[model samples]
Target: MAKFRKKPVVIEAVQYEFGMEDGFVVDGRYYDKSGPVPRAMNRIPAIKTLEGRHEISKGDWIITGIQGERYPCKPDIFAATYEAVE
Candidate 1:
């Protein structure tokens, strides 16, 4: 077996937190909001991605891939995998 390395790429991401308003759109790029369930019940925030609807926990990073796909990454994994571009 041969080892492979990941190619360097820059991606756009946003850290989601509690109390972020529904229908929140940041920089006209990120469109994050609460799920259909009422916030009173404390349902996790979710977004539609290339794969499917994924729940986003607090401090999770929403990443936009090079091909314009979106997905959620846990904070710890994100920290280990990515860095500030500038």
Candidate 2:
């Protein structure tokens, strides 16, 4: 038998809305990608309940949360939108 470990990769994203007529929103905040942005919030936020509550929105920050989730914030919105919690 052989033991294998998983490798981790990093990605970048944003949290601004494409537009009211383009994507979806949660808690009155845009979470999906749409309109003329280079990349839309095409991926749905992933939620897990392993060690604790985990969530990763479409346009979340590159950093992960305590529960291994990502803070929801559009990349286009720049650093003014959301801040990853420590």
Model 1 segments beyond 4 Å from truth? 18-42
- Taking every candidate in turn, the Cα RMSD to the unseen true structure, in Å, is 7.1, 12.5
- Backbone clash tally (model 1): 0
* lDDT (10s digit) by residue, model 2, range 1-86: 99997454443444423231233434434443433323333533333234432344445444344456544434556466444443
Question: How high is the CA lDDT of each candidate model?
Answer: 0.71, 0.41
Best by TM-score: 1
- Model 2 C-alpha RMSD vs. true structure (Å) is 12.5
Candidate 1 is scored at a TM of 0.71
For candidate 1, write residues 1-43 as lDDT tens digits.
9999999999999998766424433333334454333334434
What lDDT is reached at residue 23 by model 1? 41
Ten-residue stretch with the least lDDT total in model 1: 21-30
